[model samples]
Target: MGTNICVTFFAFLCLIALSNAQTQFLRWCVISEAEQKKCQDLKKVAASMYANRVPSYEVIPLIECVLGKDVYNCMEKIQDNDADIMALDTGQAYFGGRYYNMMPFLAEKYSPGGAGTGTGDGMNYYAVIVAKRGSQFNVFQLQDKRACFPGVGTAAGWLYPIGEFVKKNGQTNIMQVTECNAIVKTATNFFKSMCLPGALTSFYNPFGNNPARICELCSGFLEKKCSTDDPFAGYDGAFKCMSEDAGDVAFLRHDTVAQMAMNSSYMPDNYELLCPNGMRVPVTDYMTCNYGSIPANTVMTSSLKTKPEVDVYKNFLLKAAQWFGPSGQYRNQFDMFSSQPWGYFNRRNLLFTDSTQTLVDVGEKNTYYSWVDNDFYQIMEYHNACPLITARLCVISKQEKKKCEKMMMAFNAKDLRPSLDCIKGKGTDDCMKLISKGDADMVMLDPGDVYLAGKKYGLEPFVVEDYGNMNASVHVVAVARKRDHYMTLFNLKKKRACLPGIGRGDGWIIPMNIFIETEQFIPQHCTLFENLGQLFIHSCIPGAMDKDYNPNQKPVSLCEGCAAGGFRKCQRTSEDQYFSSSGAFRCLTEKGGDIAFVKHLTVRGNTDGRRQSYWARNRRSDDYELMCKDGRRTHIDDWENCHLGQIPASAMVTAKYKSEQDRTIFWQLLNYGQQFFSSDIEGDFHLFDSGTWYNDLIFSDDAVRLMRLDKSMQDYRNYLGQDFINKVENLHKYTCVPVKPSKKSSSSHTSISLLLLAAIFILQLVV
Candidate 1:
């Protein structure tokens, strides 16, 4: 019995020892040989403290070092479970968390007096521009000046300070600088020379296109130049560049100058902070004279760790700080805050920033997006902007222009590319002219205008609007009141008709082509307004009086049924009560027209309480009927078989000279815009909804989505189909006429002709 008890106790003791060893094991990733040496020494110091029963050392974990090629490699190792922890700058921490699924648990804090004193909030530091006290220039004069930066992608060194410069120089469109190399190009264009460490390495300058002047002020030689190994590569290096007169200004953290001055001959009073307003103040007033604040470096670990596991890591860091920090009793044996003793004299920050005093819990701001300031994160996003071209969209009316501008701002805010620009024109024809002249890029047009644009101005359709069905066409129907039995497709002469507009596909072109094909109406002259005037006793053809579409004799009957009071009469806009498919239906319902020409959805959209206009109140879809081409009347829902013609839907048209790539880019722009700003989204702007007053602004309000057309359907004729094109061509052959010159051009021509006649008469008299 005595032997059994002794053996059981020994087994229990061995199990306890094994459990402790397993629970205390921690592997830390290091990026440099110096960091690895420092990490090993830290392991020895931690073991010694625990064995000696140093105060608050019970939580210390057994440390092991893992070497990595760089911070990115370290992040990958931690994610893959090959390592457990690493210290990273806030910018690098963001990359790790966003790309490697790591999380930050602790942040480094600095003291106001200098490093090694543990005081400030430990969450944020200010970015500032430092220069000699009596420098002759201000912030605005930094163009073509020598500058120094810690390294590429560092918050205080590149993002915050460069963001301020971009703002001050009115580079709001700098979102166009989408890549790291593009950002370097922008910097090169603005600065005469710079010392941007790590800017020319294979990681940042993969194409070997970065300018050499970006590294002219760096102190490293040969392959180490402009790399992290460069002696001038951190906060201290940037300051040294300025102190040695290698650069006119240095971008650094607000605490950098004060911290480095503690051991050097440089005094804080010799330098001043350059305020964004172009004023200079003493470096001590950084709070009032800095560009912006960014988060500090953080100690990060894999996000897959459990809460208890994370707690263990946090507690270990806290205990290590208590024992090895500046005020610790073991400070002389192993100072965790200094790297000079570890043979890293040329490189300042190893394992941690030399300015870090102690580690603090990150608390609830543990995620990368939450831990970093939103503005600073957005600045970083600019470096990854999509490489896309910019395209201009044309708008005709003031309301459409406002909506287009809002869309541009919203798309830019989301960083969607290709970026959009809004160009305002007087009318649809003007927009077409603008696009043809290359002043604008694209516009939305109905089938009638699409044909005109293609046949007259050399434009093609690249994208088509989809209205929920695979068929990219709508039924053009002649709608009439069920009580009006006399209004058939074979209507007698001297009847009134309402048309959406002069050039609209469903409202005017299709209906007029049907009339000509059936021989119900005869064209006495090439002038459509006169022929239509003689056929119908009175008509509501909106835009009939507009000189751009007519430019002929004034027809009183065309505008007689229009409801607008003044100059807005017969205008092709929302101001005219009779201007679109819905407006034409309203004209037939209340404006004393016998027949209404519109698309199939006009009745369903405005009737049944779908529309809230006062004119459409108490209207029901059952009250309307469709006029079929076979001289038969049917219910409104029978438009699929009882319509005059089916025409293609509206499309986005651009100059035919635009390459396939250009067309694809335009399609992508609209496709992306609708994804975020579509009617289904709760965003502030709706891409498909026109306000209460307008029917369709830049695009059709009924469209649910935009789709890119197949390569074979890029041409307008092929997209509209040969049969529809033939019908339209037949109608246009009799109605279309050469546009007369404007009055000013005619007068100029007359004056030139008179001058030539007088010159000839004088020559004849001399002979």
Candidate 2:
């Protein structure tokens, strides 16, 4: 027993030693050959320090060097476990943390009194726009001028200054362009020429159509122009691009002016910083005239590392910085912040930036978002911009506006571009007018309103709500009891009819148009109300008898079959028992009506025990049959082919002047919103649900997704089809007439007309 216990203890000790051996060394990633050589030399120096028993060097782990193709490759190496640590700038650090889940452990401090000085945590610097001392431009007057940038996606070069420009001027002429790199397009249009390194690469210009002027200022030969290998490529190179008169302004770090001044003949006093508020100050005034304060470059590692493991790497870096830093004891052995010894003086920032004063622990601000300035971080979040323009959605009611606001927040949370804003209008007509006047960008509307908006307001439909069909349209069918075989379309001259409302698409317009097309009804002197009253013995067309709809005629038979009592009789509201699609269906089933005009879903939605209303309690969808246009009756399920007419689905309408790119972006916003907040997802908000109180707030409650219409079908007339358009036009041409009330009844009729208009306006609110 004693021997076994001793053997077990020995095995345990060996296992502990193996674990320590595995974790005692960290592999540092290097991008270039020069950086790799420097990394190898540093590793040898660290080994010698531990061998010589340098004071606290014993606690530091063994150093290893790992070669990577580039910064992005180094990030991949670290994430894939081939390497352990690498240095990254603020923008690269954000990409590392966001895409690769790497966490920042140490920060590069540039000066003794830099940001986060007192706490010895978090490193920060300022981004500045610099120009010659006496330039005729400010922040607002930069249009058509030449500009210089360090490289694409760098904090000081591209992210900070470009973000400030967008925030100030709202992205200028790029608002209507849709591209993978809208920022590049914006810069291309804003400046007459620029030297944005890597601006022509496939990663930044995926479409390869970026303007050549973006790279016209570059000094590299042939293929290397506008690339990282370009002669004008970093903070120093960007300064050279401006100093040599290649560019009018340069975007760089606050220290870049002074640092480059020491190496070149140009004096720092010759350059001035352009303030965001349009003021130009001396280079020394960077603190007051800078674009924004940004976080410093950081050493990052995989987030999968445990806290203790990260602490071990942290201690190793701290000891390396302490021993080999500028003021360290072994500075002569291995200068940690210098790159001139590696024979890469032209590419000064090799393994680490040459300007790094010392390395500091990032402490609690270890995450990329937490370490970066909040404004800079947010700007980086929307770095792609995608035309960074706001799309104003016009809503009819307060409830719809509130819902739109929530949708905007949800879309923003997911970083959907062309940010959304809500505009409240008095009604659907007001919303249409707002869109026509350019006060709003989009609004949702049914086919009836779609026609009105198209013909009168010059608006078009760009997106339609998909409710499980190809065109997202619903069939307007004439429904009747399956047992009523004698109630055919050919013999319905004196039959009782049911309809949703007077001018609604599925109810009145479609059926009335079909009657004229089939020659079942003929017009006589445009007296539609009198002709309809003569054809049908009784009808339940809600709003047909309202003074606002029939100003000169009050046909009693039109409201004879309606089920509502006293004050709600023949009203176009839910209070009237026979009002909308479901109400019209109920009128046919319970009230004395022969045929009900409604959409295909009305039967399935309110029958087969789906609806628990008293009138629809025991109804079944199979009990109803559709009256086909050929006078044949079929099951309600055959609505796709056996229908009176097919109306285009509800759609998102916008001004005809809106560019195709703007329409595409609007579709993208709604597509992304539905993906994240659709009814199937268990999120706080549902894109398709209008809650319990409203039927359709911003979109149809039955919408499964939003479908973008083809560019050919963007126009309302084309989308509604020529046949539908002609029918609607004929309905107005033959039946509609301007009426003048007789002088004997003008006063009483005007009062009654205003009251009825008020009631109809209230009824419209149900939308």
Candidate 3:
């Protein structure tokens, strides 16, 4: 009985060990038995490559039966966690990411002929429109002209070029009229004859349910319709279609003609390229003639994996690429990417790009949309029958009315909505008023005005514009020249200072709030403006330069440090040496003041004369340093770990009284506009116009995203204190203000603030 029990225990132990082994190695899915055998063979190759060191990878084949045309099914397997990775065509990659919720992390980089493949410059190839050299026609003359496409849904061959044609013809709204039928109907009507592989197949077109003529132009053999297996189906096939005089023009990848010219049957000199701008060039000059670059295909993954699991998989693939590159010693021993091992693969080349290139993380899910051009995705949206949402943006303009209209024209050209509509405002303040009063939907405001609008004008900040490398909240720093010795906010006491304006957040409110919070001084401590002058030895306040601009309506000692009797003295104009952040930093740099309380970026922008202004262009960055909290000075980049508190960025404000739906739609509208126009490709639509007469448009030029202003903004407001906020709002001195809180109450407040901040961080993580 004891011997039998020992045997049973040993068997159970073996089962557990096998299960653990299965979990350790990656499960690479192979489509057929033959491919499965090849996968096993490659494992030996992988082992050989890493023979000199400990192998960082182990892959086991998971066999499944699937057809080449049914690549989408394999993607579904990845989504369902039945498979781990696969190499898909670019179109399949898009569909998987968009609909099936899969991730594409690596793309194949192929070598052309014998030399290295692709430009090896991190750039993808382009789709070219090719026609016979003698054919006298541009892209626009394709009305009833014969057309040939390599395949349906191929990025370079069909989508990019067709998308360009549709946009030029103003059929961007074609999706609303017809679904997938939009492309079919448009192409069929525009072209006289065509040979589009897969257009009639169920993979692309409906099986016998759609119109009969959809496949009429296709040259298929007895009952074998539009299969990629057909010789006349890919780039070579499309070229053949044109060369045989069966089609007048062909839409294929840029290198197709050059590649085919190597064949005895084809001549490169016979073809020319149709440029999108109604021009023509020889086929060999396709680099300049072709459409914009398309993204390469990727080996995708599902979002279900943990970070460690994802990292392991990514590392293994990267190791494989490095091991198999041309210069690697293992290159002669094995061709891991070759098609001979994988029977049902799409192309007769390696699984990865010809030569091993870098593997980029495209992220999981629909985030892959950025890889595809905004124009192409918009076209895909139309073709896929997705609703196009347009929101109208209210432009707050004063004198640049025509320029606002021109900006709108540029925006519409890129098709961002709600399209901006200019609503003339008397000034910046008036624009905020218009938005609050429901006369306009939204307006961008400076930090100070945003605070004012939110507290008193019934408007709430939804999005904050990003500037430079900083986050939505900027630091309100106290700047001092390197020669000065200062430590902490306390050192600023009784020092000559420069402020951009009395009403500006960075210049006044934030600094004053810090002073009050630190208990160094109180507003009640000074009854007259004379107290402010006493607080500082002398000060330059630009807003108070004009007698009517001060909130207290008393110029008093605020203008004592003005730029002498010149018009620039204490003036709010750009010509004023201390009018803005740059100006205030200049005031400190030029020795106008012992210290300058300006935005964090101000010191960095003007140091060493990086400024565009004539006065600041020669300043040296090394001449100044930031004062830290521990009474030590450090380099400017170290401000995060030391120095003044951060303030919120400029915000896009809207009436707080609006319906939830209205507010939600307004936020969505702005977010959409930012997403499309923020990319380098959309430079034509300058959402933040640097060249305009106005310094900034609705957003800052460096703005990346518009995040919801949740607790961080509230923290900043809380730091300012309700009493100080009210004092600013009433524009008057306070007689009876609540005394500073007891230590116990302050501790309770601190605990509560920490909890709220933790909650906000958790919420962001969840999102």
**RMSD per model, one decimal:** 13.7, 11.5, 21.4
Between the candidate structures 1 and 3, which one is better when assessed by lDDT?
1
**Local distance difference test, candidate 3:** 0.59
Candidate 1: list runs displaced more than 4 Å.
1-294, 297-389, 612-618, 739-767
Of the two candidates 2 and 3, the one with more favorable lDDT, higher being better, is 2
Candidate maximizing lDDT: 1
Clash pairs, candidate 2, are none
TM-score of each: 0.54, 0.59, 0.43
lDDT of 2 at 316: 73
- Model 1, 1-767: lDDT tens digits are 99889766754553444444434568999865677888988876666566545344244466789998666778889999999999887767877887689999998877654332322465567888999988898877888899999887678778777765544234444223423225676787788999987677544554477888989899877866776656677878899899889999999888778767766688888999888877999988887787776777899999998887888789878878887887877788888877764566545667777767788998998988788877776666555343445789987777788889999998877556667899988778888778877788999888988887777676789888887786788889999898888778887478888898887798777988888777787775566677788778988888888775676736789878888888778787666878778778988889558899988878887788876667776798998899988899999989888988888999999987677767866776687678778887876788887666666667776778888889898888899998877867666556655433233322444577799999999999999
TM-score leader: 2
Residue 489 of model 1, lDDT score:
81
Evaluation by TM-score, superior candidate among 1 and 2: 2
lDDT of 3 by residue, 497-582 (tens): 88866666677766666666565556563243444666777888875634334435443567767564665466543334565566
Candidate lDDT scores, in order, read: 0.77, 0.76, 0.59
